[model samples]
Every structure is written in C-alpha cells, then in structure tokens.
Target: MKPQLANRVHTLTPSTTLAITAKAKDLKEQGIDVIGLGAGEPDYNTPQNILDAALKSMNEGKTKYTPAGGLPALKKAVIDKLQRDQELSYEPSEILVGIGAKHVLYTFFQVFLNELDEVIIPIPYWVSYPEQVKLAGGVPVYIEGTAKQQYKITAQQIKSAITDKTRAIILNSPSNPSGMIYSETELQEIALVCKEANIWIISDEIYEKLIYGDAQHVSIAQVSDDAKERTIIINGVSKSHSMTGWRIGYAAGNKQIIKAMTDLASHSTSNPATTSQYAAIEAYTGTQDAVEEMRAAFESRLEIIFPKVTAIPGFKVLKPQGAFYLLPDVSEAARMTGYVSVDAFVEAILTEANVAVIPGSGFGAPSTIRLSYATSLDLLEAAVARIDSFVRSKWQEDLL
Candidate 1:
C-alpha cells in the first residue's frame, strides 16, 4: 500500500521512536518482561494542578474548537512565555499553537519550503528531519557532527554546508538521542554564521526545562537581533511540565511565517484542543516549582546511569548535558556478541535480556545505541547491569 502511496510518502519511513515502541509492546504482549528504555516521555505524572485545570475547562464546556491561531489567552500565554523565559519578544499575532513540536515543524516545512529549497540539518538530528523535508519538497543538507565534539556541529560546519538554495537550518537542543545542549558560546558561533548567510533557524527547544546539571538551555533567538528576526522558536510543555498526552506545542516567530502556519492549521485540525489549551495556560502560568523538581530528578538519573554504561566493555558514552537520554557507543559490544553490529546487539538485548533500546542507526548514527533513563532509577540500574553482563560474559571480560 505504501509503495502505491504518494511518491513523497513512499520515500519516508515510519517514525523511529514509535516503531521501536510498537516492537516493545508486541514483545510485552507475548509475556516478555521488557524494561522499555526506548520511550521519550517523562516518568512523572502531570502535576495535579495542571490536570485539574484541564478538568475544570471541560466542566466549563470548553471542549469546542478554538481559533486556528489559538484561543486568545493561549496565544497570549505563548507570547508571554517567550518574553519571560527566552528573553525574546513577539506580538500575539506572531504566535501559533499546534498539536506538538512535531506539528509546528511539519506545517512550517510544508508552508514555506518549495521544490529543492535546501534545509540544513545537523546530523545525529532528531529522526524526523529528512523525512519532513522530503514531504515538504525540500532538500535536507545533512552536516555530520562526530562523537568527539559531543555530537554538536560547529559554526565552520554550518558555513561549509550552506548554498543559495539553503532555506532554513533545524536546531534541537537538550537534543534527543544525545542530550547534548549547546552552550551560549556554542550557539553564538552558529548564530554568527547564520546571520552572515541570512539563514533561517528553526530552534527546537522542546526540552527547554529538562536540562540536567550545569547545562544552560539557550534559545538561538536570544543570541542577537538578527537571530530573533529569522528564527522560529518551537517550545512546548511536553517535557518541562510533563504534558505529552495533552498534545500542546507552539512556535513564536516572524509575523509572516506565523500567519502562513496559522492559515494552514486553520484547515487541518482547526486548533489544538480547547481543554489542552486551558491546561497549557496553567502549564506556562503556574509555579516554577514543577519545572525545577522534574529537572532535579532527571539530573539524578543522569548522575547514576552514564558511569555504569561507560564502564561496560566496548561502551563509549559522551556525557549528556541535557535531556534524559544517553547515547552509548556499542559498536564493540555488538562485535563481541558475534552479530556483525549494533542492530543485532539491540535485538538480542531486547529479546534475551528483556531490555528495550533504540538502535543508533535509527538516529542517523550507527554503532551507538540510545538509552532513556526517564524511567525509575531501579529499572535504569538493573537495565545497565544486565547489558554489562551480557557484553562482558559473551565478549570483553577485562573491560568489565
């Protein structure tokens, strides 16, 4: 059916995260005891007040469609959040809310990208970049950042990748699959390059408040005047406030792009849910306590998980600065098991050890595997031990 589908659709694959999740579920239903580390959601429940706000909205008959741009209050809240948190200012008209960060991005690519308009994508990117570019009829120029640099590309790398056809560059921080956050200094370098080239930046800061330790999450728009004008800042409460299922996300940007996306969203889903909008209002306007509390827990997990994984034979882990996932280089671990490489190692671990992880190939970086410590510390500790033994007993004894 997919082969007979639209040419653009056929060119893309199913989402890597969801695919691994489905595989894990199939194993679980078959009575396998799998500790799934492949999920991206926070383990915490949505804070009680935020949930109560949604329930109250429903009781008030707020279930109807909202304006495509968003309810006046939610859009205004998005505006306030940008100014308050990112130190970037925008008119309420410049805000557009949608289903999630994913929707905001997909619609932006569809609306503005034309045939062969190149989008500069940093490699080891979130898995959806190339697929979305293809769907939007744009070319994705991927620039690979090696593991040595903590999977972050430099200003020189960006300068090298641009061409006249390049339209925008996607930037995700407190990055998924890597948890690498760009420092203020690092973002300044990239911003200077983009300003020199007059390039647009799609800054994905969905994990804005989930950073661990000393990681400072800086919005590219906040770097300078030029960056703020050309950048579309994507943010949401999915990670920060534990609101993934509520499906609220937004973009604060230049008026023109915001208008185009609002128009596109007007016909597609109309608006994000009314109750979700109300819930998001609480998410943004509520106390700062929940944000800090969640960050503390995630930091603790990172403190515990990274050392153990790196101690395993053939394992290489770059300390993740933000987000909740650590990408452990498992190339040698794979060879030790006699299965050629990582994909095999991942399969064996999932089936035999009942531990589910995402293969690095899914994230555009083979030989490295992604492990999310967003679950209980007990599960994380147990998962790493099982993996270490599986590798050391079967392969490298001395490293363990």
Candidate 2:
C-alpha cells in the first residue's frame, strides 16, 4: 500500500499564478501564440551594475556561505535603506534576510504563530498569504475590501475581525492582484487599531518603490512608535530592481522576532545565495536611477492599457496606483457570454483567445480576474485586443 501523505501537504493549494503560467508556456511550446499575463515579476532585466557586482563577488571567491541571517554589510545596508527611504530606524540586530520575501514571510509565520492562531488577511491578497499561514498551522481570517473603497479594508472592519486567537494582520500596500495602495490616513487608523489590540502587523512592502502618479507609499511601522514595535517590515529588491531570480529579501522589526527568524534560518536555508547578497548590496547602496526608470515604464504601460482594457464590453477596472497588476471585474462579461463562472471564462480566454490571466477566485475575489501588465506594451495591447475580440464574438453568438 502507498504511504499516506501529511495532512498539511495534502490540503495545500498550488499557486494559481504559477499553474496558469505553466499552462501558457506549454501552449506556446506546442506552437500556439499564447500571450501570458500571469507572471508577477517585472519584464525588465536586472540593472547592469547589480549584475557586475555579483560577477565581482563570484570572481573574488565570495561564493562561500555567510551568516544565516545575512552578511553584516547587507544587514547594515538594509538598515540604512529603511532609515533613508521610510524614515524608520533599525539596528542590524533587528534585521533578518532570507531566500526571498516569500521565504522570509514563511519563516516569520513559523516562528511567531502557534497552532490555531488566526491571521487577519485582507481579501484580494497575494495568492500565497493564506496558504503560508495555513502551512504555519495558523488559521486565516479574511476581511473583504469592497471595490468602492479601492479594495482596502477599513480599520473598523479589522477591529470587528479581531478575536483572542488573532495573532497578526497582513497588510500589503500597492497590493498584489489589485495594485491598490492604502492612504496615510487609512494606515494611521489601522495602525491605531493594531496598537490598541496589541496585534502584530506584518507589512509587506515589496512594491514600495513602484508608486505612480501622485500616490505615495507609506510604511505602517512609520505611523508611530507603538506600531513600529509591533510591526514587521518585509521588503526586497525583486520588484524594485528586477531581481526576482536573485532570491534576496529582508525583514525588519523587533529584535526578538528577528533573532528567532535568524535562528530558524540557521537551520533551514543557511543564507540567501552569497552572490545574490553581493548583488543586493549593490542594489541597495548603488545608484537608484534604474528603479525609477522601470517604474516609469510600468506607469506608461498602465496609461495605455487601462483604457483599452476597460473599453471591452462588460469589464470594469480601477486605475492601479502601484504594482503591475489590474484586477478587472468580469462577472458581467461571464454572464453576457453565457459562462457560469469566472474560472470558466478565464480558461476559455486561454484556450480560445490564447491570453492567460489568473482567475480571481484564487485570490478570494471570484467575480474578477487579475491581469499582470509586466510584459511589453505591444504584447499587452495585443492581449487586450484578443480579449476584446473574444468577448465580442461570444456576445454576438449569444444574440443568435
């Protein structure tokens, strides 16, 4: 007889974004002209200076393992960055680096959560948040953020969701899936709630440098000292520097938590890649012109694509303030085309229109679909046209 798998492993859902991207690649490899908008990484190449730094590190035999938490220089760099960018101060002892932001988050949940601890997560969150909580033996309590509010939940909603079991709340600004940023006032209110409840706040600021238009990114930890004491900041060079494959991300907060995470990392990943650490050092302390250049590119793409996407019949989208995704409500389109569900509509688009987008059901927003604008402008335009044509054709068929 076959051995039974662990319940935790059995119940885990594979990442929907990766699954769809893989399917799109399969179709492309089979000679189909598939345009995939499922990936979350920037399309831009890693900056040349960052690349040169990694090469230099390797040539100098810096490939040997460093501290499990991170190199002293990298941790110091992270500390300097937090101070400079967010106006927040941190000691090196309060920093912990991991394979990536995702790993840092996972390690955090493992170190902090007890069995049945509840983590309040806003809906339309990154696909991994709830699953990561579950993997840590924690229960996820979801609060829905209405479209009218730009998909940001109110502090009152957070207060209502709190219970004795509530351990932490995950806040993602310039959020994944929706690309909605929380205003300073909204964050101050939420921070007040967290401070009163003494709930830990896990602020994922991976897209901090990608704000567009007049929108500004604020760190929850910067709201007040109490909030800073209770909040852990997670960030990386992945989105800002186009270094997704570099596998370097860091966490900053209470030294006790950082120490625990470092101890955990000591047993697990050992350290982020040595060369990647060197590359990240340059990414942080080197020139930042490339960061703004990429942000402008994304903003330019958004300007061109947002209108085109909304013009499609039965689709509605809010202009994103940051990040590279657009969550468009497609329930009307699904119903108009005689489809029963958004997932079916998404699959049909992949199969018929040859355009890949992640279904919103996976992100707890079933009436919508998430499209990444992290591809070239030409490809985005073509994908939008294909989706427009596909929906129009289905609408016409329904008329018959």
Candidate 3:
C-alpha cells in the first residue's frame, strides 16, 4: 500500500500561477513561442551593488549560519528601513527574518494559530494566505471584496466576520493580484475594528515600495500605538530590490509573537541563508535608485498594456494602483467565447494562443484572470494582443 500523506498536504492547493508558468516553460522547451504573463517576480536582474555585497560577504567568510531569526546587522537594517519609510519603530527582539516573505508568513501562521481557530481572509487574496492558515490548523473564513469597492474589504465587513473563534485578519495593501492599496483613513478604521475585537492584524507589506500615481502604501501598525501593538508588518527586499531569488523576508510585531516565530524557525530551518541576509541588508541600506527604476518600468508597462487588456471584447479590469498584476473579470469574455468557466478560457488561451495567464479561481475570484506585467513591454503588449485577438475571433465565431 502507498504511504499516507499528512492531512495537511491534502488540503493545500498547488499554486495555479506556478502551475501555469511551468506549463508555459514546458512548451518553450518544446521550441513553441509562448508569452507567459504568469510571473510574479520582476524580470530585472538583482542590482549590481547588492550582488557585489553578497560576494563580499561570502569572500569575507560571512558564510556560516546566522541566528535563526537573522543577523543583528540585517535586523538593524530592517529596523532602520521601517523607521525611514513608515515612521514605525521596532527593536531586534520584535523582528523575525525567515527565508522569504512567504516563508516568514508561514512561520507566523504556524506560531500563531491553534486548531480550529479562525482567520478572516479577504476575498481575492494572495493564494498562499488561506493555504498557510490551513496548514497551521486554522480555519479560513472569507469575506468578499467587490469590484465596486476596488477589491478592498470595509471595516464593517471585518467586524461582521469576527466570531468567538476569530484569531486574526490579514490586510494586504498594494495587494497581490488586484494591486489595490488601502488608504490611511481606511487602515485607521480597520485598526479600530481589530483593536476592539482584540485580534491580531497580519499586514502584508511586501509590495509597499511599488506605489504609483496617487496611491500610497500605509501600514496598519502606523494607525496608532495600540494598532502597532496588534499588527505584524510582513515585508522584505524581494519585490523592492528585484532580489526574489535571495529569499529574505521578515516580520515585526509584538516581541512575544516574534519570539515564538523565531523559535519555530530555529527547529525547522536553522537560519535564512547568511549570504541572502547580507544581500538583504544591502538592499535596505544601499542606494534605492535601482528600486525606483524597476517601479518606473512596471508603471510604464501597466499604462501601456492596461488599455489593451480592457479593449478585449468582455474584459473588465480596474487599473492597478501598485504591484505588477492585473486581475480582470473575464467571465463575460469566457461566456461570449462559449467557454463555461474562466479557468477553461485561461487553458484555451494557453493552448491556442500560446499565451499563459493565471486563472483567478485560485484567488477566490473565479470570474477573473490574473495577468502580470512584470515582463518586458514588447512581451506584455504581444501577450495582450494575442488574448484580445483570441477573444474577438471566438466571439465572432459564436455570433455566426
């Protein structure tokens, strides 16, 4: 008989974005022309200075294990970054650095949750949020954020979702998938709700540095001292520095919780790679010119391709305020093209048009599809044009 896997593994859904990206890669291996719009990482190489920093650390023999939480210098760099960017103060004891923002968040859920405890997740969430909660033996309670609200949940919705089992709520501004940022006023209101309920707030701020136009990134912890006590700010250098492969992310919050996460990390993974931590320190402390340059490139691509995405026969997209993705509701396009579901439409696009986009079903927004503009302008433009042409041709065939 086959060995039984843990129940936890069964509940976890494989990341649809990764799956689609792998499929696109397989086709490319076969020498097919494929434009993949499914990437979540920036296409740019790591900045030269950060690369040099990593090499220097290794050459200087800083290649051993750091403290399970992080190196003191790296933690100081993170503290300085928080103070400089958000005016939030933190100490080394209150910070826990893990492999990446994703892994840091996983460690957090593992430390924070108890079996059957509830975590209130907003709809259109990052795919890993609910899964991580489940892995930590927490129940996921979802609240929907409509298109009219720009995919952001209101404070009242959060209050209504709270129950006796409620342990925490996740707030992702400059959010993944939708890229909608919560305003300072909105965060203050939500902070009030969490404070009243006495539950934790997991503020995912990995994309905080990528804001464009009039949008601003605000940490829930910045609302007030009480809010700061109740909020854990999750952030890292991956998105900001184009250092996704370096795998350095961190959390800052109540010292007790941070300690608990750090303890867990010590057993599961001894430390974040020492070299990556050095790279991250440089990421935070170095000149930020490359960071801004990458942001400008993404904003430029968004401006150029967003209109083309909207021009598709039945696609409805909200212009993203930050981050690199566009979550467009393509249900009408799917229906007009004779597909019963958006997932099927995404598959058809990959198979027929050789364009890979993620189905939003993985994000709890099944009617939509996610397109990442993290690649070059030529590729993004070509991908959108292919999608538009595919939809138009299918719609015309249906009419005939």
Please estimate how well model 2 matches the true structure, expressed as its whole-model Cα lDDT.
0.94
TM-score of candidate 2 to 2 decimals: 0.98
Per residue, candidate 1 scores C-alpha lDDT tens digits across 1-400 of: 4446667877786665676678789999998888999878899899888989999999989899889988889888888888888777889888999998888889999898999999998878888878889899999898887898889899998999899998889999988879998888988999999989988999999988887666688998898888888899888889899888989999888899999999999999889989989999998888878888988998988888888988998898899888889998888778866667788788888877888899888778888889998899999999898888887768845433
**Which stretches of model 3 miss by more than 4 angstroms?**
396-400
Clashes of each: 0, 0, 0
- Give per-residue lDDT, candidate 2, residue 54: 96
Q: Model 2, 99: alpha-carbon shift in Å?
A: 0.4
Q: Return model 2's CA RMSD, one decimal.
A: 1.3
Computed on alpha carbons, the lDDT of every model, listed in order, comes to 0.87, 0.94, 0.93
Each candidate structure's TM-score, on Cα atoms with residue i matched to residue i, is 0.96, 0.98, 0.98
Candidate 3 local lDDT, residue 26: 91
lDDT tens digits, residue span 326-381, model 3? 99999999998999899899989998999999999999999999999999899998
- Residue 88, candidate 3: Cα error in Å is 0.5
TM-score, predicted candidate 3 vs. hidden true structure: 0.98
Which tens-of-lDDT digit does each residue in 1-400 have in candidate 2? 9999889886588776677778888999999999998878999999999999999999999999999999999999999999899989999899998999999999999999999999999988888899999989999999999899899999999999999999999999989989999998999999999888989999999999999999999998988889899999999999999999999999999999999999999999888999999999999999999999999999999999999999999998999999999999999999899899998999899999999999998999999999999999999999999999999989845533
